[model samples]
Target: MTMILGFPLAPIRGVIKLGELLQEQVERELRDPAAVRRRLEEIEQARAAGRISAEEEAEAVNRVLRGMQT
Candidate 1:
């Protein structure tokens, strides 16, 4: 006999699995060295273009460099 009680939970389980996969992908990118360097370059360009203040650039550079260290 098939149980109907478990059917409703199937979509919930699939959503949870999808969320886990997304988290794993995000973590992998965060640890990538090239990704960190690219972010630093972007910050520099923004600063040069006056899109960000000098203080914001310094803060962003520090955050990106720290991410590289870890």
Candidate 2:
């Protein structure tokens, strides 16, 4: 399985289904300015704390943004 920041890209049907559901949930629930801001803040903190590399943080932030698109 390929992992996109712990998000697994898998051949399993269940995983794919769950991914779809998660995407929908995020779109409906977390697709807002406040949600985006919080995600950004968390990413920045992780980067400053040396928990995740700059590149990893960028990828994660990009993914969250792309997911928010309608």
Put down candidate 1 lDDT per residue, 1-70, tens digits, no spaces.
2458888888999999999999888878887978987898999999999999999999999987776566
Candidate with top lDDT is: 1
Compared with the true structure, the alpha-carbon lDDT of candidate 1 equals: 0.87
Query: lDDT for every model?
Result: 0.87, 0.83
Give the TM-score of each candidate. 0.76, 0.59
| True lDDT of residue 4, candidate 1 | 86
Write out the backbone clash pairs for model 2. none
The segments of candidate 1 whose C-alpha lies over 4 angstroms from its true place after superposition are 1-4, 65-70
- Model 2 lDDT vs. the true structure? 0.83
- Highest TM-score model number: 1
> Ten consecutive residues with minimal summed lDDT in candidate 1?
1-10
RMSD of each: 2.5, 12.6
Q: lDDT (0-100) at residue 17 of candidate 1?
A: 100
